[model samples]
Target: MHEWALAEGVIKTIKEYSKDKKIEKVVVKIGELQQIDIDIFKFALDELKKENSMNKLSIILEIEPAVLKCRVCGKTWSFSENLKELDDFIAESIHFVPEVFHAFIKCPNCGSPDIDILKGRGVWIEKIKFKGE
Candidate 1:
């Protein structure tokens, strides 16, 4: 699934970037809008790491809140505040394609459909620590 793919991507990226260096720790940031299953992602990472012979590597994941800004009113709000309004189908859609959020969500303050995603849209590596300084 996507989680597995994402895990593989992380491993591949680390391997490519840290060539010949042993990785000590990797800090990855997960955007809430992606709706990734943290437990599954971690498991995938562990399995993939082992397969890649990265046994000593430590992976850390951080969840970032999805923030949206109203284009009309300039008000910012957290996605969590509007989660209760989303149906299962819509949630699933956003999970796979976050851009779909624009169709389902609106500015909370101004009730405007014009909104901008301020943060928490994708996954990325925040920091990487090698085995030695």
Candidate 2:
């Protein structure tokens, strides 16, 4: 729910920029670490653009992993790699309904939980393709 509130503002900005030009699609570069629910963001966009069909640009997410960098060894790793157990556990708990993997960052190289975040930290509008000219 809190994520939704933050996303509403993003949607507003996206739409405002596309006010003059008819948008073809909206491309969002979301860092894997942001942990945003894509479903919620899409739903919000769909609802908001229901009125203006041309303004209704489809949501395209460029999902990058929220990665951590090892300060000691200078290695980079993704949090997704560490979620195998959690993913399996969720599926088993849900009776094999097919679930997605979710994991936390804990550096394997140095075994340090204090690794620096290298990428995938925030949500950004990378580019917006529009039907102009």
Candidate 3:
């Protein structure tokens, strides 16, 4: 899964940021739009930690819901609210090309195809709790 690559990047970033310090905990915020497999991501992190002898490191993952704004009506709403309206094929298509979601999905208020995602677009490291020397 691509989550492995993402986990690897996270690990690398943490190693760089922590330097000689020991890492105690890491909190990651994952956007819902990313559709990451949490199990795979966790497994990758665990494996990396084991390989690096960082058994004490604790990993926390949080999922952020996507928020979308309508360009025509200025209406904002959670993407989860309208998920049921999407057909299976359209959903699959959007999963491949998220930028084209507006082409298939319309604003709930004005029925306009013009839309913009206000939040929950990518993954990020939220917090890092480290042990002081």
Give the winner by TM-score.
1
**Evaluation by TM-score, superior candidate among 1 and 3:** 1
TM-score of candidate 3 on Cα atoms, chains taken together: 0.81
lDDT score of residue 30 within candidate 1: 95
Best by lDDT: 1
What digit string (tens of lDDT, one per residue) describes model 2 on residues 28-95?
Answer: 88776555677876676666566445354677878877676778778887766754544545534322
Q: Comparing candidate 2 with candidate 3, which one achieves the higher TM-score?
A: 3
lDDT of 3: 0.82
Q: Which whole-number lDDT from 0 to 100 does residue 117 have in model 3?
A: 87
Model 2 bad stretches (over 4 Å): 51-55, 84-106
TM, every model: 0.93, 0.66, 0.81
The Cα RMSD in angstroms, rounded to one decimal, for candidate 1 relative to the true structure is 1.2
Residue 10, candidate 2: Cα error in Å is: 2.3
Cα RMSD (angstroms) for every candidate in the order listed: 1.2, 6.6, 2.4
The lDDT of each candidate is 0.90, 0.62, 0.82
